[model samples]
Target: MTHSRRSLLAAGATGTLALTAGCLGFALGNEPLEFDSDRVAPADETVAETGYEERTVEERTMERTEEIGGVERDFEASIWLSNYSKSVDYMGQTREGSAFAAVSVPGMEVAGQSVNPLDEMSNEELLTEFLGRADSDRGDIENIQQGESFTLEILGESRDVDTFVGESELEGEPIDVEIKLTSFDHEDDLLVLFGVLSKRFAAESANVELLMESAEHPIDT
Candidate 1:
């Protein structure tokens, strides 16, 4: 964990003494909380005010097709966009029930214009550049170790994906991390996707492969 995150955890831990950690998770990315006050509200009231509900939902298989860059494309998956963690670090989960977390801290990097200078590189070069940058960019993650590098497809675009192993301290408890990252390349532009999940969930799901294959053929598969 980074020093900044530790500080947030410390503050949140202290703040959670009066309230619950769920409240802190609710405040995750919404607003800067003012904890100087001594007011303590009931747990149910606190939950009601935040309006962040934790839900376990089953996924539905679906497909979407579109034309981009004068080429036809298809996207099939068992999950739709679940922005349940919009105000937090995660994106959503796959139909196989794995969590998708942000690779770069929000606002630290934007998906606009594919700032990826490797857009013109060979597949080998792109994978090499991406793994190195990913190691550096994810500073908020702890003990991250790169696993493998390969090409994959998303939304009919072939791109390089790298597997990673790391650690995360959720609610002050350490959890093993496994993540896959890739970019959807289209017309010299890119769409980056990052998925982070616990070791237990990783062992139980084929979501990583399914997501990469959603568009039909994953690169180098």
Candidate 2:
């Protein structure tokens, strides 16, 4: 995975909010979460049919601060993430495609917000934070056109997700792309999936959806 794209995904992972009305009363903890990359990521055989190959799966630690009762508290959060990508030569040019999944710490409260910012955050706020990356000049994605919200099955459950269409520059060449963004609870953590594929191939390919569907939570042994 490219450094710029990795950084973009890391930023998006940190900005994700998983709080909901049912979770507002949960206690806050300062201890960092733990994750096993193998258990959280999809199997290689599963990714094979998706067209994109699994590039990397690892644990990431991020630092965040929140103010509570006028006191500043720093928190270290853990994310188990995976990157899938593929490259195809088309019309004498190389087109790049990618997708990412990050498992979020359940009940982690974001900074600058009250006790339970996650629960208080609206759909607009959450989507805004997730999609904000598309507007970054430091990132390759640009000219984002957000589409409607709908429900889809992920990790065996139906969840609301948003779709986006955009353009990105790869090695000085422009490529049209389609994106799907969704977050849902699985086991004890919240999983977020951000998928992007070449527009030309998206219609004819179900790779992105296949990648998501094939993921497993690493059943306990």
- Residue range 1-221, candidate 1, lDDT tens digits: 11111112222333322223443422333323211101111122322333322232222333344332232333232221221111233335222224432111111111121112334554334334433333122224577777887776555556678777877655445767677766443322233445555675544224444433443211211
TM-score of each model, paired residue for residue: 0.36, 0.64
TM-score of 2: 0.64
Q: Which lDDT value does model 1 have at 131?
A: 37
- Candidate 1 regions exceeding 4 Å error are 1-98, 101-140, 203-205, 215-221
Kindly provide the TM-score of model 1 when superposed on the true structure, using C-alpha atoms: 0.36
- Output the worst ten-in-a-row residue range by lDDT, candidate 2: 1-10
Q: Please give the distance, in angstroms, between residue 147's alpha carbon in candidate 2 and its true position after superposition.
A: 0.7
